[model samples]
Target: MAAAGVSLGATVLCLLAWAGLAAADRVYIHPFHLLVYSKSSCEQLEKSSAETPKALTFTPVPIQAKTSPVDEEALREQLALATEKLQEDDRMRAAKVGMMLNFLGFHMYRMLSESCSTASGTVLSPTTLFGTLASLYLGALDPTASRLQAFLGVPGEDQGCTSRLDGHKVLSALHTIQGLLVAQGGAGGQSTLLLSTVLGLFTAPGLRLKQPFVRGLAPFAPVTLPRSLDLSTDPDLAAEKINRFMQAVTGWKMDRPVSGVSPDSTLLFNTYVHFQGKLKGFSLLPGLQDFWVDNATSVSVPMISGTGTFQHWSDAQNNLSLTRVPLSKNACLLLVQPHGASDLQQVEALTFQHNFLTWLKNLSPRAIRLTMPQLTLRASYDLQDLLAQAKLPTLLGAEANLGKISEDNLRVGKVLNSILLELKADEGEQPTESAPQPDGPLEVTLSRPFLFAIYEQDSTALHFLGRVANPLSTV
Candidate 1:
């Protein structure tokens, strides 16, 4: 009897080990890696799956929206033709990436600036906005993923699995941009910069998000707080809760309370970015200076003055002049002002042209006196609203599979991105008395509504885009 019992126990142990081995053969790829497409990555994915790749598919019901269906086929073909001229090898290079990012930056800047022109100034972090969209791409399935790829301007004519947009590459490039800022902000750098970014994911109470999806946000933000809140309970209370939570975490207050949360919503994505840049040789003057909000209106705002040899360009044809001011070894600030006869709207519209930003490369150095208002600007807007205005309200709507975000169907509510920008001018070491005086260096004064962008010097990667309509207005 003892021998028979031992034999049965041994048989059970053998069966258990075999079952474990079979389970181990079925590898689970994180949703973050699903969008990573490469020949070797594809091979690895195939080897990990015990069954066909289709077996690993996760398709959820699309979050419903009240809008007309978009022509996906037409959009895809248009994008293909637009990028057909570029050589395949140049598609994902640094230059192309810069242009692609600028393209998206100009689009978002236009939407935000135009909407806020009547009310207040507009400021946006293009890198942060791009990362927000890329995070969603990680949770999207094809058709939805393809649409995002087209919007992202990922180089490639084919949108198949083998040639899918590489989320990893996009995130990596964004990370590089952030790293440049950090290096430029280090101690003893040419300028003093403080940049803080945080992403908040608020979900319905008791809702569970995919662990992999939450972890995938690491590349985009150092801190991503995912919390459960009953958003529908009381809109006012919900806003307070989020505001208090963000304040406690980052110590920065939102200029306005978050709104547009829906009772039926399942998730609200919000990102807060705070940026402060102080020029080394620029110093704030004591009294307020006149900043023309328009032809007839003017406001007294704190002003900063500096004298330096800066790169300048006057585009008489476009009725705008640009000045490139160094912020650090790897970053510079582009200040663009329209000619007196031209309005901000006209100059802004011209930015949509393909070669508009290339003007940065054509600037010539000239010694000059520069004065501008000290800027403390804040801008807050929802991405969904922008999409609605852009006539693609159904882009993230129902029929879009977001299975990777959550097993339970998710109805995304409002995706908000906010910015708080503070630009100060500091007095550096006093100029030497023996230095040669320029022969009437041109004087450039930004006393009116103007556009500004912070860019990585080498790559020309746009970090921030904004329009200062009123130096006194921050919203």
Candidate 2:
């Protein structure tokens, strides 16, 4: 219930901002203004009496490594205090941060989907990516800091320290969002939703890391494990080591070893996220169904179907239809599919429009029979590559100052953000074999390439955005 109220006002504010403000409130407030902080204020907050965040060390563990013991009560107390600081203006600011991350992650999703359209579809965790950038911002200095700030959608950066933003506030807001999701999801038990994240910092041997910088990452992930590895000499071995370490610690098995690590790089920031959603009224169909990857390509895959009243919209003008299926009381799934002969590319282009989020707001409830694949979508990408694609090659390049993270002339390696999404029928629900009535629900089947998004109903936050071109591919 607490999670439901976290930034609940933000959803209303966003709607008012976009849907046109009332006559009494004609002064339009830009969302970014909510997050702006004066330099003096940021400095004062940092010097406050809050306990210093614990510094994590890069100590290597064995192949079958076990997670270090954590004092659950102590960690909870610390998090509760940190979150308590975010109850007032911090809530709206966190909501704005979530919005900013959604925009950035949307663009990244587009770029990735384009590059991998033929081979496989793509998935991105906006929250995880935001945490990665926020982590980097923790160590950035001068122009690098300014650039990262701009990338984060904070305005008025050109002005001076008076307009500087507090990295702690942003990271704290991010932590609040993560906490809200876990709390809301767990309220329904494992039968509804289960979400987890792990932050892995793979550093070069003997690279001295700053205490404050390492300590600052505490709130952004549940498990922040920094380890030393011989990444440069044998990249394959390092990848295998990371996979083994994660499996040993979290019991999460990766489909393949991570690739694309630069041998010259020093620190690799890796975040792994897992999310599973079980539909209430859905059940697996008897056998495989024909899924149209494109107009010409098709494959047989497992399908699930259910009949229920769902929030839906058909944008005939844009040649696409939107469907919102409930995953839990706090989260839902948005499915967008192009009509007629239109393809996934056409649907992707629609995201660039200013009124994209409005589509979600405009959905109307409709009784329909929805049939879609039983998805186990997996995606991996290096943040460095995404930066290059955005034409910001030097944001983390050699010239950047990262003194807060390390003194060595460090080459930032692959900032990996791996995501896995699983959606299946709730085992408690039984499949119905009754014949359709004369006035049956409208049938809407996803047999072609389409786009999907996981959204938080309470905060109106976009957690994950992705496209599914083929049901069989899990890249």
Candidate 3:
């Protein structure tokens, strides 16, 4: 009887061991990885059961929630202690700021790399995505802490030494993380939890106290202008005016001529202007058109054209009207010649009013010190010699550069111009007649800070630039 009992016991033990091994094989440690593993394991189990007569009991292991217990009272005391310590230890504050910035940079790269796909449609690798998200998470979490260091006005080495860890920064960071997850297509309860936690952290006054005073002050600050402008508009008159301004400011000419027949002696041109002063404000006024031209048939209608001190001759084409202005050395004047011979005077008057109003709208009454550090103008480029150099993306195919331009490119141009104007306005300066010579590419550099604003004339919607200096500080 004893021998028989031992045999049975051994058989039972063996079965238990086998079951344990199977469970180990099927187990997934990480919750995220479980979705992929669970399906495969269940399929395998079903196949095995079909082949074998034995019953295979499969029980899924409960996912262990990984969380640290938080005693609210204890955390408050610890945080208070930390704040006191920070007041004395400059090294600690500096270390924290460095950690936060490193984290931020990582996430910024991650989000941008993941969200933006190349024109060819290649997605970012998982490893890359992970790294990017991690970086952004860290950065968003500590902006206030970092900004506080900036505010204390501490000099190097000792700077940020006494900085406080802003709870607000943590909340902001969490919010940003939730946004990034949504952007990456994550949905469901986990995302909701993250958002809720962030909101709760922000609502706590003690946590809010941890944020920098400057960060707190952000909400009460006045709206500023943008660093760029988008002046590209349809209706030949608007485009023409913008082009003339660019020519007058930059001393450059359009690579191609405007489409359609010029009115008797009238010429069509477009130019991108550069100004040194900061932007203030901008407004647009709608008025009745003096006359209408068949825009659908017009090929390249000149926006702005005039003879300047640095004149360059453009090769003539029958279907196009061309104008070249040189703005390199001296202040240049540009005369915009409108199409339609019968209403030539009306066109001229409209063009002049449009230019004047645009200029006036951009100059705001509120004064703020603003400067533009850089500016760039992008347009369709025509390669005079294809064999001379490998064609880059900017070069339009054999199709005429200006003639083949699409609505998207025009929209992009307008956005860019509007942003520029806004940047100038934010700096509390008005655009003046300072046509800085282009040293390298078609770009300009401002001596002071600036603001940016963008407007879509078609939709009449204003798009503000989200930046550290702008109204939307958290983004």
Candidate 4:
């Protein structure tokens, strides 16, 4: 009986080992052969998927307001040529902001998604997060700076010097993208985008800030310093003071965001972003659109409609469809929607990769009639907590040397980032005659939970990343 039991145990162990190998075989890569991936396995999974690649059948239409210039005979060719020339501050347009956002948005999604899972709507400023990190990069020293460079995706200035990470260059690139959006009527035309960036460093008494760090922020952030308060006691008072300061800075238009303060801390880093945008040729649909909350539930909210020739893409593997509508002269609103039959969670894995934005650039130009809810989003996040969630708390922890920010032994405390985005169409606005008549137009509606991002066309970097699962929910 003991011999029989031993044999049975050995058989069970063998079976478990076989199962483990089988599971790993599906996704595992040999450490030494990292470049090699199983094409057959990937193909098998794609072929087995229920969703089919959507056909890009929508015919292209002329895209221009009545007051705007006439569409050229070679309009599509002209657009393709123009788009090819698009470059922002020496970085490729495809990865400029997409790379940074993919890094930061994942953390924000992980940290905020659960809280928003209950309410069903969440917004994050990838640009603000990027700027904050750039500021941190400016203040960090040695190993901390090296770690930050990796986090910010700064590929060093070629071979000779891998020692010092250039924070100014990274910040300037981000600012250049913003500059393209904020410029009034460049060769691209008048933009309907209004973006306000404010970066603040609130330091306790006595410690003097560095001139280099102060000047470094000028290109990236309009407001870098000039406020202080006792962070020692009374969390409520600190909140009030911060709120009041923010109000004065923003003309009292934003709501107060809650934050925690440390008694022993001497410094607080804050970044605020406010965005207001309007689609030039889009019109508001008078009725509230039905946005599906789940398989059996839905909510009603105001929706806007637009029609024009736009770039569109669909993926069968991820169960997602995407399109780009120019939000301003230089910024485009890239919208993604999962099939009504599928949940938002179905396409979520795509966000973790750079492929999400890459797919947008490869879309075929098609005529589309889109209906989406007007956007009003206000969110605040603690950068320190986000960094901790990223598993690198020590990079900006109490032990961090932020000498570039100030000469004293400053302990970096709470880092707060606040964002306000208001996206809407003009009341009683009407679409131009050139707008595609809905008869056979590719009708795309955000009547279900969908993801949206506003990216600079010149740089292709996302400024705002958000989703509207329940539009009526309080932000």
List the candidate 3 regions with Cα displacement exceeding 4 Å: 1-95, 118-424, 427-475
Off by over 4 Å in 4: 1-119, 155-162, 184-188, 252-256, 287-289, 295-297, 352-354, 426-439
| Pick by lDDT: 1 or 2, better one | 2
Residue 362 displacement (Å), model 1: 2.5
Taking the tens digit of each residue's C-alpha lDDT, what string does model 2 give over 1-475?
A: 1221232335434433643333347674434444556556757756763655544434344334457543433443343345434565666666667777776666666667667654367788888898889889888887788777767656443565556656776887787776555443333343266666778877888776776787788778767887777888988778787787776766665675477567887778888887878887798999799998767889999999888778889887888889888776457888987785454576677753255687877898777789999999888888888777666777888788887787766778778888878989885743234344578877889988887888775456678887787888877
Superior by TM-score: candidate 1 or candidate 2:
2
- 2 against 3, candidate with superior TM-score: 2
Kindly state the number of residue pairs that clash in model 2.
Answer: 0
C-alpha local distance difference test of each model: 0.67, 0.71, 0.23, 0.62
Candidate 4 local lDDT, 103-133, one digit each (tens) = 5555556566655563366777777787788
* lDDT, model 2, position 259: 76
For 1-475, candidate 3 gives per-residue lDDT tens digits of: 2332242334334323532343456563221121112445546746876896532222111112122322323322332233223222233222222223332222222333233221111111111122222221222223322322222111112222122223333323322222222121112211110101100000101111112322332111111111111122233543354344333433334333222212221111111111222122211113211111222321211111111122111112211111112111111112122222233334322322223223323322221112122222222211112111222212222221221111111111111111111111122222233244444212111111111222112111111111111111111
Q: What is the lDDT of residue 375 in candidate 2?
A: 93
When summed lDDT is taken over every stretch of 10 residues in candidate 3, the lowest stretch is 193-202
TM-scores of the candidates in the order shown: 0.79, 0.82, 0.17, 0.73
Ranking by lDDT: 2, 1, 4, 3
